[model samples]
Target chain A: MKMIIQPRDERTQPARIIAGYPQTPLRSPKEPLVKRAPTLSELSGPLEVAKRVKLLGGDIAGQGEKQAIGQLIHLRVRVLDEDGAPVGGAVVEMWQANAAGRYIHPNDDDHAPPDPNFYGAARVVTDESGVFELRTVKPGAYPVPTRDGWWRPPHVHFSVFGRVWLARLVTQMYFPGEPLNAQDRILNAVPDAAARDSLVARYIPPGVEPYNALVFEHQIVLRGRAATPAQP
Target chain B: MMIPTGEATIGPFFPPRYVDAGANDLTVFEGRKAKGEAIEIHGRVMQEDGTALENLIVEIWQADAGGIFRHPADPRHAQADPNFLGWGRAATDAQGNYRFKTIRPGAQEGRAPHINFMVMFSGLMRILKTTMFFEDGKDPVLMAVPAARRSLLIAKGNYEFNIRLRGENETPFFDD
Candidate 1:
């Protein structure tokens, strides 16, 4: 018996290589993607990923005394398969810059000061409803290190592991209404306007949520069809 | 119509503590060591320019030494080794090198002993997916790959599987 994966629809993906991103030209292959039918290796994936890594719950904001200095926001993200069904038990691992746009990583020598309170990495498992809520400070926009004057809009990097390896997806979520979203080479790389809009989270004004932080609602749609029944 | 979310760059800022030092080891489960021949897979992730690509995350999923997977998708899930942790993740060091400690997986579904590999980094905008196999075994899927490129999937002497993102030496990556 053999299991198969739904081949990716290229129109929804960004060009493997982006022009402005200096690393893309060198690292991305000019060759076309190889095609093949998936076997058990592709059908199965890691189970209980949360066990290996600590699940810090939803909040990734400030520690005890000092708080991360940014507009505190409650971001609710839903992880769903493209079939419109909830994807329970999926793991969503995420990381972002501090309110000052400085990452705790040593490579980030950007002038933005680091918030001692903010440890900007977290992982959570989606509930049976396919939703995971996050409480954190809004990440700040940062400039690209390149001489070109490109700056990234406030966004969060997401690594999603669905029920199967074929459903795994890694992407960035942009905040709606940010001017940078329009100019982001990566976001614009998707040819479909609707798909690009899907990457941007919707904002809800404060006072609506019980918490003081502004609310942003986002949904991540992983590639559809975990397995298409084994063929004898 | 179903619309899937688009891809984006991993960017340069992976948290230093993405995973603890123990992430590189997959032989332990609930404090008990797994059963079978323990082996190590080491490799450097290289960018197109031939420079080492640092901070890239390498994750692998494989069946236990008994050729069983704990995942429900596998029919043999129930027989999986209770003490064998089948998943491992490690980040590249400053030298663009990453290593994983685990036993050589048993053949699964009549396929060869292999570890499913995925690469995530700041440079490439999407996940780079591949498989690592031992030199002795022949997987039908690896055979499906072009004859010239099949060598890229096999770990050579010393079990080193260096990954090149591009160029003539690039590894044969599959799209799903």
Candidate 2:
């Protein structure tokens, strides 16, 4: 049967600009090519680690001195873009140690101490300028298994949301100048010295009462950079 | 503004960065570098009877190829972006066809979980939401591609991913 081919211009109409769905129109080469939504490169940011929520099940809050009531580790974080603008609609999840410096999960098994009431898990979404906060206790040092041997350090875990499974991240925020930091293998594995240092927060004694509480200010960064291709 | 309708329920929190980040205009790019590959994201949103529906708004989000989210909370574990959201929106066409041209999201934290997606249409009661996974290949090497591309494939040399609405054979909720 004889076939009629459509004109090239007629076949190459750009996709109809749908109002909301930003990623659409998968472009194609052949005829009758209705404009295809574009395929985007992977997105990135400051923190990208994945850990199971259900798996985090130890308790580390509710211990320490009675003065520990307000001994929470206050976190002030700002989320920004390449242009230094705050990003809206992003979500953040943080899990940290309680006042007694322990995790609230049963799996943590850090017998150094126990804080029955502390579960150290909270979730928050960003507002118009991409800022989020978490009221938690300064994580205490805990002995964990490692290749060299067992080591302990004070730290908290954090996760960010891009959307759904994509947004999930699992990472720890360590306290700056903590002696144990020098021995932590994972902490040392980070190649970027400054980036690695950024993960550690400094403590400022809370001004109220006995001044036992510690305050940490941390800034997290998320970026999408591909490793250089391996040489043949 | 189009109000979401359907049975799907969404969580109350957006990342602090998303909440505080300012607005961005999507209409600024003018070159091929800014141009994304267009693909047919055709799928059916059905009733228990498997009947197709229309006018539904399907949303998607993913990180760029380098595996960084446009938003601040990305799992870079270090470098953060104050802007990129990696999120997008689209309404299904007459044949339950919905499409988007978003960057493939990176596999943060190692598990490489699928990105969450949601759909809301007219007639249906509450919003219907669910998560979608990148179609990673059987081999670990191939599986290493970012979650967004793993969810996408070259069908007839065209990048595409067909979405399915909740009912049977699809995920149940959005937040999980």
Please provide TM-scores computed only on chain A for all of the candidate models, following their numbering: 0.92, 0.59
Model 1 RMSD in Å is 2.8
DockQ-based CAPRI category assigned to the predicted complex of candidate 1: medium
Give the Cα-based TM-score of candidate 2 against the true structure: 0.41
TM-score of chain B for predicted candidate 2: 0.55
Candidate 1 retains true contacts at a fraction of 0.68
Maximum-DockQ candidate: 1
Candidate 1 residue lDDT tens string, A38-99: 77667777767877777766788855676777888888898877666677888888899988
For candidate 2, lDDT tens digit of each residue in B1-176?
11100111111111222111111111112222222322333355554334565545555555544455554334352352333344554555467665554444455544343444555442222233344555543523224333344333222223344543333333233221
What residue runs in model 2 are displaced by over 4 Å at the alpha carbon? A1-38, A41-70, A99-101, A146-148, A163-169, A204-213, A224-232, B1-176
User: What is chain B's TM-score across the candidates, in the order shown?
Assistant: 0.94, 0.55
What is the alpha-carbon interface RMSD for each candidate? 2.2, 20.5
TM-scores of all models? 0.94, 0.41
